[model samples]
Target chain A: MSINEKDELLYNMENRDVETPQPRVKRGGVHRPFLFGFATALCLVYLMDLGFEAYKFATLRETVQVASGELQTSWPPPPPYTEVARVARYVVHISDWASLATISTAAPIKGFPFANTASVSDGPVGLSSGTPYFYISNLDFTGKDLLTDARTTVSLSEAQSDYCHTSGFDPEDPRCARILLSGSIVEVKNGTEEATFARTALFSRHPVMKTWPIGHHFFFAKLNISHIYVLDFFGGASDVSVQDYYKATPFP
Target chain B: MSINEKDELLYNMENRDVETPQPRVKRGGVHRPFLFGFATALCLVYLMDLGFEAYKFATLRETVQVASGELQTSWPPPPPYTEVARVARYVVHISDWASLATISTAAPIKGFPFANTASVSDGPVGLSSGTPYFYISNLDFTGKDLLTDARTTVSLSEAQSDYCHTSGFDPEDPRCARILLSGSIVEVKNGTEEATFARTALFSRHPVMKTWPIGHHFFFAKLNISHIYVLDFFGGASDVSVQDYYKATPFP
Candidate 1:
């Protein structure tokens, strides 16, 4: 065909919109064979989606079951107590102001020979509360030392004197409760309502509170309680008095 | 003394109002040597209290300084870019359905002749701009497979096709960008407002949206863009059509 004719034919074909009829082929021949490409592709894609869905469902179910199990075992009642008893304790030390004057007794002096002499004025005394409470003057060296190194041991003895054979003393030579407290000394305010109640209890129970002035200090300490050790002298023989009097009660 | 005499003496002593006199000792004698107990106790106590106070003060100072430093360093400025440019390219596999049909090319048919027909009654055609977007029916096997594994690779040609040789194509012989994205497939709803915006942008760039039905299946994936190979097919030519088009107009 001529070049112009070929160009004309291409233009006619491009613009045509005629419908074509279906073709026929012999039965069971290669031309008429069934194509499995589309079916196989469809099956593979469907199977993959199903597998992913199944995996996701299983993982979610397991997580839920584990959370339920944890919730079930979290709540129960507390255990019973079988070993409860009382204990008495005390701490003694060589008075820092007057080394010769020792904390020989924690009880009231009642005009003893060493009560108010030049070498022995009324010294600050610590009570047997879980956290110790004591009176101190801003001028005393012992008070300053306690504020610095709050961790110190005080000695204790049941015997009233070095000679155990003194009258009105026990003959069996029983052991005495001794303890040491180790913690930092912090200054806290006495602004809480409970402070007044604590002061009243101190005045009624301690002779020193009644005898000496103790309300002038700017800061009082709220000690952090760490540990406690009680050495029982008479064991179970004097259980009632020892337990009731010596147990350290925590401050409010 | 007899018991009667001792009792009388004790009663008299208790009621006595007599004051005790101070004792005097010689200053230069060995018995009058200076005592160091009081001085030593005071020194020790004072040193301890001072040490504890120093420690507490140092710790508190350190904590406060650290917190202040953190607070100071936490404020600054941000960046100035508005629309960040991200280039994403991918490869996709495509399958076209064909049907057997016959018609006269130049003259009328004289005898029966066989023709190979492709099943193209109801199928899809794949296309791409920067990323390939699939449009398939729910019953298609390829669609099912994509939902299942969602992992696939496209075998691309190294030679440029007719699409890349268009009249306005900037790079004369461009090396096609090929990438394989393997990830789990998710179906997103196109009826929502966010989907509507995304669909409009996609459809505006490609005319295939007019042929595909709405709400048909499509894959949403987290694609891994990798295996990049750059070829100097266009002799390192830089395409400046986009830049020229953008710079043709003066700034407002």
Candidate 2:
């Protein structure tokens, strides 16, 4: 097409909403196969969302059935201050959510720290990997902050788990155990095995994550930790080397 | 004095428990009135502890007396998402703990972001100041981080409050509300009105703060917030100006 015709076609496409489908769209010489593929992808995404909702419903039904019979939940966690590496790994595994702190790069408040209550998991239920994953959107300040400075911290407290609350350990007490780490945050490229694993780890613990608005452009990011500082006793923070953090098992 | 005499004196002091009354504690050349004054101070402190225990016992009895007549607590938080300033203030006031995010400057992890699970309060009970205060010990990583880089962020979620859990709002939902702030963390000088306010605000919410070890060199700190971002509803963060944030009345 000539330049004038191309400009006219682009203007029409830009102004038109999806609901205002143009029967004459192909008249601008746009190909049919491209539109067909785009439409198919959209339908598949919708179907996947529906499938996820159905799965959650079934899971909730099973949980309710189980709860009616027994009110107690099977909480398995190591005693606080037992061993530094082991406790750190166990807290990371069982805690469903934590605040992710990052250095801000936003206008006028740049370089300050920012934190958000985040849905996080190291691996799927009953499987501990010692690495926390996040599914986040760029629309959020945290996502933008990570892009500018990927040095991040994920701090988890055993108070987040029912075991601590039930055992009468107050959150501020050192005996409740807390883990703080400094790490590098990196985005998981779409269409990769790590991305898949990240999604599974997050969604299994926080099923609502699967239903967040798609327009937000959610992506998975993982923190590769270099330092681990834990507090589980009165004297001082526990001596947990990064080498010990990753290799330690979540359970005895 | 001979070295053996000095050693003997030290051994006697160490071997004698608190129950043993030394007829000649001054025989080792220790002053008499100094030791007596110290013992008197210790006894006064113990008596004060007993008084506090009695006060708590009476308070518990009063609460039990009141509970017989009412099934609900007199919690007076504004309905979630009612007004931006009011809700933000309420969350900060009612939340006993939040994650304090600071730019790390500690050795081996300098310049990275660090988060610590912190106990916080905005004001003494029922009087919301719309500013969060922290009682922190310099021995903790967060305290050290803030000292080097006072720029900090405090993120709070309504999930920390019973409002969300009772109303069936998920912690991650926008309706559950969240607050993000960037500010400078400064030590509240002792004997200042703000320091008194900080202590009152903190101790009233986190009663355990009053009992934390004194050797840790705890201090009162408050975030002089420059920016406030609040998410109380679906579209995006509410446009809450700093002046509005400070002056906004907590409730009618």
Candidate 3:
């Protein structure tokens, strides 16, 4: 060993003796060996406890199971049922798709009220306009229905989400919440500012719409909401004014 | 020690000596102390491994997570998309609730197409009738609309279940599957056999309907399906005849 290293080892040994005072073992007094052993055992137990927690964290990650297709992610709680306007708007804002009902113009079942599954957006993410926009093709049934009769109603249910189903509330339960938007779906005039905004709103929510075939004669249309119907609680449906619906923020 | 125990101990020692031949450690043979230490270490490692596995299993039980509202349970995989009739029936059979669209007779928004969330059932559990039954009251918007015009459409989507969302499919995507049943809503005559069956079907699927106020004059109704529209694949929607839709088993 080098001379300096040898000196450092001697100093460390001397310092250790000074730091840990010698224990006394006498009748009616604490025993040094027993106390030392107990302290060592406690440290070992603390280390094992920490190791178990780390192991549990790893286990949780490995055992994560996806239920119904809903990833285990957290979202804001829904608004209370008393806020009819807010609940109505919240349903529209959160849903990516809904049932669009229109008077059919096509044959076989012409003039009947037809409901088709449609994807829609109120506005771009984080911007709730209370207006539902659609990107539809003239070739599809809903598109054909829209072209023939502009009058339509979009139906949205909290049941469409895990919200009601998981809460043990039946989809039809008033507390589960349902919204119906009745209005005329008008095609935005091409090249208009509203049309541009509609495209941005619909495409941002449904990215695949951007790559849809052009030959299908797809066009942008929006629901000019006239009347709002909300069923959020037991007393029956309420018709909220369009102005109040617009004034209320869905975030509330 | 007792004479008999002393003799047994002596026998055991002699047997052990005979069973375990002494290792020659003159220079190149195995050493006793080293072998004993290694064996003891191996035993401790095995016990630790077993303890770790038990700990992991306990951790898994404690950390179970519920996603969306879907309880972690196993369900059969959906039928292939090409089975148009089967897919249509499957969408109807699997859905517990759907969007019921009807022509409105109420004033203000009267004569407009109105969509309402309705809970429906095809038949009692395990009996797929390919026909949807409803429990409606004249007090509700849907019931009032039905009183005016019986023509309606019930829209069902695989999106209602976690199937589409968990599979990364948008609700509007054709592969997500949607069914539109266009038909006339006819009330089952009260006190008749059909009414009895309708009540059984509707009540079984939606238990909450049983507790709905009797004052609302809730009555049973069924859709006399005339046409079926199914969109389950990338191609355009298919027009499946009502006959084929009934003939195909949803289980297939």
Candidate 4:
């Protein structure tokens, strides 16, 4: 059609009033086909919503189903308690932050065991490297403490996530699970292959770390993981030998 | 009115067809008054929904607002960096759990700084005691560690909540805030006033603590705050005198 004719047709389509065909009844504004199309679109949208909800429910099943409240995305159901080493690694792998305990050399409270919260990574999302890496600056107490004494214990807990809260397990409850990696925490030298891997592992989980101010003297450090301890059941703490802990896969 | 007459009237009200009057058109069915009533009801419901949403946003402001992302209930905007004591108390008061650092006497890593996750309460919600109380059992390594040496430091972070993460602050970033209350963690003598307060402080936040196994020998313990250190700004850590820390109010 010519441009003027096409424009005229478009205007008619946009501005024309829908006609109702009933002989006696007055027109109710909306056309029948348009109403039918709207209803069909609603049904399609509803089905898409249901599909999306189902997808969310399936992928986020890590969230526990609590008896009396809203659901939360949870860590993978902790491995069977009998699989001690696997449970330990599961706690380590899911935790993005850990508490590093170091002997303080700072004055007054000098020589005391000081705990500092440190963001950590074992590896990226699906890959568990079995070693906890830290992005720390010398200005912080934990970093300063490490400068004086490298001995530290990195603590990870299932309580960090919604798992324990939704499951009704107290943070201190052994059933809630806690993992401790004890050893010397030493800084990885710049330009080393391990440092590169540590950067990927940490920055992937905490993207904002890369933008931190350079004046803080941030460096990559890791736990030597000489000893492993896990609390996952009623009986007491479990000791997972370092050898077995490294061999176990957190994701089953 | 007679029962039958009242019933007949109710039936007419319920079953009568709504009449729409017009000049040349046949009945269009719905009554004008009924339509007006439905529209008014819808308006009221919409207003109530808006009010409820506003209430939720106001009451749960602890979650932070980031430049890009869904809004979250933020913690009270953190105190200025200059208010060192208030900032320290703020971290301790809002945190329901903390990482306790103790010198381990456990066999494998004897004499190492071991960190354990502990559910802590400074006081019930809105009541800041400035002292962290713990519901710990002897079965856990922390309990055993306490038995050997009471010297410990309780570490807390704003990162424990969604505030830091949502605000894009890395957990280790000093601006994200960390508080270390250094002192001895000692058990309160049973049946004392302090022990009763400690129970209220802990169980109020962690209701499940009341149901933990009885054989575990759980007891109430408090951190005797001797030194307070807060890392909230770029320069380095700030020390809030113990007296000043107790005097400051977290919620202002």
| Tens-digit per-residue lDDT, A1-252, candidate 1 | 999999988877876544343344223542221223233434555687699899976554332110010011111111111111222222221111111111112122111101000011111232324333333343332244444344322212222111222122121212322222223334434767535544543333332334444454523343343332233343322222323433522111
Give a tens-digit lDDT track for model 2, residues A203-241: 776666778889999889888888888888787787689
- How many angstroms is residue B51 displaced in model 1 relative to the true structure, after the best TM-score fit? 60
Q: Tens digits of per-residue lDDT for model 2 on B70-129?
A: 011234555447488777776666666678888787777887788888777788767888
Off by over 4 Å in 3: A1-74, A190-193, B1-75, B191-193
The per-prediction tally of clashing pairs is: 17, 0, 1, 8
State each model's CA lDDT, in order: 0.27, 0.72, 0.78, 0.78
Q: What is the interface RMSD of each candidate, in Å?
A: 57.5, 31.9, 8.4, 9.5
**lDDT of candidate model 2 versus the reference:** 0.72
List clashing residue pairs in candidate 2. Answer: none
Ranking by TM-score: 4, 3, 2, 1
Give the least accurate 10-residue stretch of model 4 chain A, judged by summed lDDT: A64-73
**Tens digits of lDDT, candidate 3, A1-252:** 999999998988889758775543422464444344445545665688799999976655333221222222223456778888989888887777888998988798899898988888888766888989888888888888877788888888877666665566788888888898999988888999988888888877777787788898888888899988899999978999999999998874
Best by TM-score: 4
Per-residue lDDT for B1-252 in model 3, tens only? 999999999998989858786654322553443444445545665688799999986654433222222222223456788888988877677678889999987787898898888888887755778889888889989898988788898888887766775566777788888898999898889999888888888777677787889899988889999988888988787899999998997774
Q: Of 2 and 4, which scores higher on DockQ?
A: 4
lDDT for each residue of candidate 4 in B63-169, tens digit (9 for 90 to 100): 44211011112357778878999998888877767899999999999999999888888887778898899987877788999888899999887766656654556
DockQ of each: 0.00, 0.13, 0.23, 0.21
